[model samples]
Target: MHGHYRETAECPGQTRGESSGGTHLQMHGHYRETAECPGQTRGESSGGTRLQMHGHYRETAECPGQTRGESSGGTRLQIHGHYRETAECPGQTRGEREGRVVDGLTSKYMDTIERLQSVQARLEVKAQTLERESNECRVQTEECQQQLRKCQSELNRQVKQSSCVIQEKVPFNDTKTSDYNSLNVPPHNKRHQLKARDVAGQALGFVQDIVVALLNFHSYTEQRVHIYPLDSSIEPISPLNQKFSQYLHENAAYVRPLEEGLVQLHQSITEDTVTVLETVGKLKDFAEHFTSYTHFLQKILPYQLKSLEEECRAPLCTSSLISKNQELQSGMKRITSVFDKLHRYIILLALPSVRQDAMPQSSSSAVFTQLAACLHSLHDAIKEMSKHYSQKAGLEQQLPTVTQKLCTTNECLLASLGMLTNSTDKIATFFSNNLDFFTSSTGYGPRGGVGVLNPLQAESMLGNKKKASDYMQAIRKPRAESVPYREALLNRRVLTSSTESRQGLTQQVVASQEKIARLEQEKEHWLLETQLGRVRLEKESQRIQDLETQLSSALEGGGGSPASALSLGLGSPALTSLDDGELEERGVEKDAMINTSLVGMLTTTPTNEEVRDEESREQLIKTHYMARVGELTTQLQVSDSKAVNFHAECRALAKRLALAEKSRETLTEEVKLANQNITRLQDELATTKRSYKEQLSMMSDHLCSMNETLSKQREEIDILKLSGKGNSKLLKKGR
Candidate 1:
């Protein structure tokens, strides 16, 4: 029979043998020598070959080649070549060589298979580790994207709100000038006067009352009027009252002088008609001068008084007061000159006439003297009036310093207020600039590029306009669109999260499938190993049966030696039964021992209970797994609910954003309307101011025209008076 043997120096306890006669054997430790194989020294001689084969196997196992198929084929070829060389000796038969080659091929094939399995296991482990890392990377990427979206949304919202607030805060300053203009117009018309005819008529009426009173006095006293007090009620009072009373007493005493002067005038008139006419002409001239004087007083004095009062009350500048004082002094000089002319005219009229009248000389002389005295009193009254005006002017002069101080204080206050307003405006501008900086610095659209909006950009877009409502509306339109844009972005984020979750779930399922596949492969490998062990055990049993049959055959042929017989009979039942008592004793002993061992086993190894415990543990594990699954399901449901709530909140936020956008739009529209109204009002104010200016110009032109006309009329009157004088002189010369 041909046999193959394997020897491993590293594992001395294990041995394998294969026979061409259909006997395959495996052994552990040293094998006992059998009598049939006493001459065979094959085991010792094959040890070197077995050591070589083990070294080859070790080499193949330690340094695995990249290509399994090629390496295995090459190793098989090398083993076949080694076996062929070993079998190629001259004395070797073809059968042994073929069996050796077949054995070497089988050994090499087993090594290749083991190497492939180990390589596959390592690859599977690496693949699982890589998949886990990839899943972690995916989760981190998703988290980062979500964070980015949140930051972007928050930034956009803040920018929009800031822009809205900025749009809401712009100011208008044209109304103040209009108010000031309206307040200053009344003082100009306050100084205008009534017509000259009306003033002259009033003066004429006053003259007529005076003339009637004088005539009544002359008739009642029979051309003699007493200068004393008429009643006890008359008394010295205030200076103004005392002056008037003294004038009345003096007028009463002067009535006699006036009668005497009138008697002298009557005698002159009776003596010569020419003299009478000349005297009448002189009286007419005096009347004309007095009437002119009264007209001047009535028409001009009140305006001058009002002007002086206004100047005194007003807080005019020092330079203006000084100019006004000079004007007043000049006017007083003019008035004093007119009074002196009237005084000379009065004295000339009071002189004794060239021709005497028919009346008493004494009465005429008394009348002339009384009239002169009355004229002197009138001159004194004029001087007093001038003095009163001078005193008023002086009083007004004293207030110039106070008025100047007040003006300076007012100017300083106005300047301070202006400075404060300017400073506040500058502070607002600084804050606005800061806001613009923040707005501009914030990133918006994409890839950290330029921002969506900034205050400076908005202002620039609005083109330096005072009103930015239109620009705000334009901005709002885009911002309104951002609501939907943000919603879409949120939806996309949700979808991406769901997709990532699904990918994670799929990855988990794939990992689980890989684990299940690896477990199934392990189970199949274990079952194959168990089947190989069972087949090896059965082969060994068959080999032992064959050995027993051969021994029996040798004994039956009567060729077996006694020793061989003894050796064979060692396993026979008859020999074993011959010592029954001792065997029985031993058997009893064995049975007792076995029984004790069984009892010990029964006591020590509670297999059923252990199995029950294991099953309970499994049940507990299953229950725990189920509870975990339930918790996870509940968590998933809660997460879904949270997602739904988040979606609802996002929707609500979107609605609020939309409402805010609408409100912003409304505010922008209102602002636009307000801007339009302000512009319209400014235009109206401008037009009104232009009209007022034009009206003032027209009034000034008309006043100048009226002044020129009055001057021309006065010049014409003077010319006419000169012509009348010349004509009268010519007429008098012709007569």
Candidate 2:
């Protein structure tokens, strides 16, 4: 068997030698044929020769044709000799040539397997790194979401608290009390009450005097008749008299209306005086109610809120709510103070008996002065009426026009007085609205509601309602010319107030938009970072897949032992050198045992068991890499999805923010325009007030001059009557 094995191995070697020599001879013959061809150039011949040499070198390197010590020329000669011997030997088999080809392919496959294993190891390390990074990114995302939720909750809480506070603070009622007690003035000392009563009595007396004077003037004017006859020589003799007669004729049409207006003025003043007296009586009761309400706010509401907060411990149980409650209390105190000042102003204006030494000049004083001016004008008109009836200075026509103007001025003053009284109604409304705050169980009051008005206080409230109704009725009544003026003023005020409200709303919208914008920007940044992380994870996954593909290719191509594949060129330089030494030693041993083992090594296709083992190991490695790649891919996909969701949310928030910003900008512009309108209205109001004051001053001056002229005329009439009486007695004696 040994002799047969040796012969078989020798036969294959001799066959390989013959095949290599025959191939070389064919190459040389082809080169010679190319060189000898008529169509072949020198460059083509040289190129063909070089190509043959390169092929020979590659063949020798892949499957050694001769010993390493042999020169190229000697090796060729030996190869030719061996080829002659191999052709004559006649014992070579085809299987031997196939085995040699398979061995060469297996060696090349081993190199590829080594490279694939190395790549696989690197991919695994990279995948592990990516996994760690992805985990970190996930943790960061979770943390960010947690923070966002916390911030949102906090903002909502703050908004709720602010809205609640604003609702509690805004007063919605408009009530005014003329009585000092109604304004919560302390009545412990009767001195203030006595003072108030004295002031009211004095104001009533003044109103009575004005009423009496107006009535007398009306009766006197109604009785006066100017009869124009051809008998009297009462012609306008001088230029001044002619001018006065012209004015009298021009203003004659106003006489009847002036008389009617004066009657209405007297009636209105009388009614206003009665209303004031009635309001005075209720002031003490209103004051007591207001005091109780303030006490409830300052003492009861806080205590209730504290108890509720202690019980609930909700988000509403914050210091800010307490602070707002305190602010409300302070505002109530301020309202009380303003009410007191207003009450004192009313007293000063109404009561001439009250000491005016300490009374500061204020709007009330201006109103009083204007009222006095109206009375003075009415007194001058009465004197002018008397002068007209006497037919002295031809001033009857002028008197009617001046009297009409005086009556109009008095009407304006009465309207102003009504407004002044109505102005105090705001204090009552403020008190009522504030008192209502305690009525709400969820707002400032306890479970058992407080701040409610008692039945005893209902009587005082009835007066307020009556007064308001009366005032409203008065307003509803038709005033021929004043209606348009009042409407214009009201429209202007409404425009200004609406503009102010719009501005406030705009500011709130702007602030909300800014908050939304900040949130959106933060969300966008987080999404961008997450997307980058996902991209990194995907890149790692792709690398892992690439490594897996290479590993699979190596496993398919290399049918070598797994140990050889794993250990081949995949270590530190020292380890690689040691592996090289071992491989060389194994090669020497294999060469020495070639005669015995060549057939076994070459003819033995890897045993099914070994092949299966290698394939399974390769599969295991591939599966491991693929599993890692899959895990990374899954992580990438999950991260990508998360990033996508975050991006979508960010985009939505951005859109909302942009809308809010646009709204805020529009509102801001509106606010600016509203402010401008308000300024313009204020300027107009100031101008009107100034012009009215000037007209009043000019009329007052004219009234003083008219009063002086009437006194002189009355003296002249008395002098003329005494002289006529003396002349009549003498004439009687003469008769």
lDDT of each structure? Answer: 0.47, 0.48
lDDT of 1 at 673: 73
In candidate 2, which residue ranges exceed 4 Å CA deviation?
A: 1-619, 653-657, 717-735
Tell me the lDDT of model 2 at 319: 54
The backbone clash count of each candidate, in order, is 18, 11
lDDT of 1 by residue, 1-735 (tens): 111222122223322211211111111111222222346577763564455445655754565433444543444555565556556765765578689989999999999999999999999999999999999999999999999999999999999998887678734322234322222211111111122223223333323333334434323222111111111134432333333333434333433333333333333332112221112323433434454444433443443334344444445435655455456545645554554555454444433232222233234434444444444444444344434434443544465344443334333333333332232333233333333221231111111222122211322322322234456567777444345888999999999999999999999999999999999977755554444335435655786697678777868877779667656655566354455478568546644543343211212335554354335544544665698799999999999999999999999999999999999999999997797567546755775798799999999999999999999999999999999999999999999
Deviation in Å, model 1, residue 701 alpha carbon? 2.1
Task: List, residue by residue over 1-735, the lDDT tens digit for candidate 2.
Answer: 223223324334445454456456655566657744759887887686666656654555555445433433454776677568658856755577578889999999999999999999999999999999999999999999999999999999999998888779855322232232232211122343343344434333333333333333323222221111110144423333233233334332322333333333333332223222222333333234334433322433333333323323323233543443344344334433443443343444433212222232234335444434433333333333333223321222233333443344334333333332222222233223333221222121111332322223334554554577688799999878755888999998999999999999999999999999999977755554444335435655786686567556665678666555545423435345566578679546643543243211322347553354345444544665698799999999999999999999999999999999999999999997797567546755775798799999999999999999999999999999999999999999999
In model 2, the Cα lDDT at residue 152 comes to 99
Residue 516 of model 2, lDDT score: 97
In terms of TM-score, how similar is model 2 to the real structure? Answer: 0.18
Q: Judged by lDDT against the true structure, how good is candidate 1?
A: 0.47
Instruction: Find the 10 residues in a row with the least total lDDT in model 1.
Output: 184-193
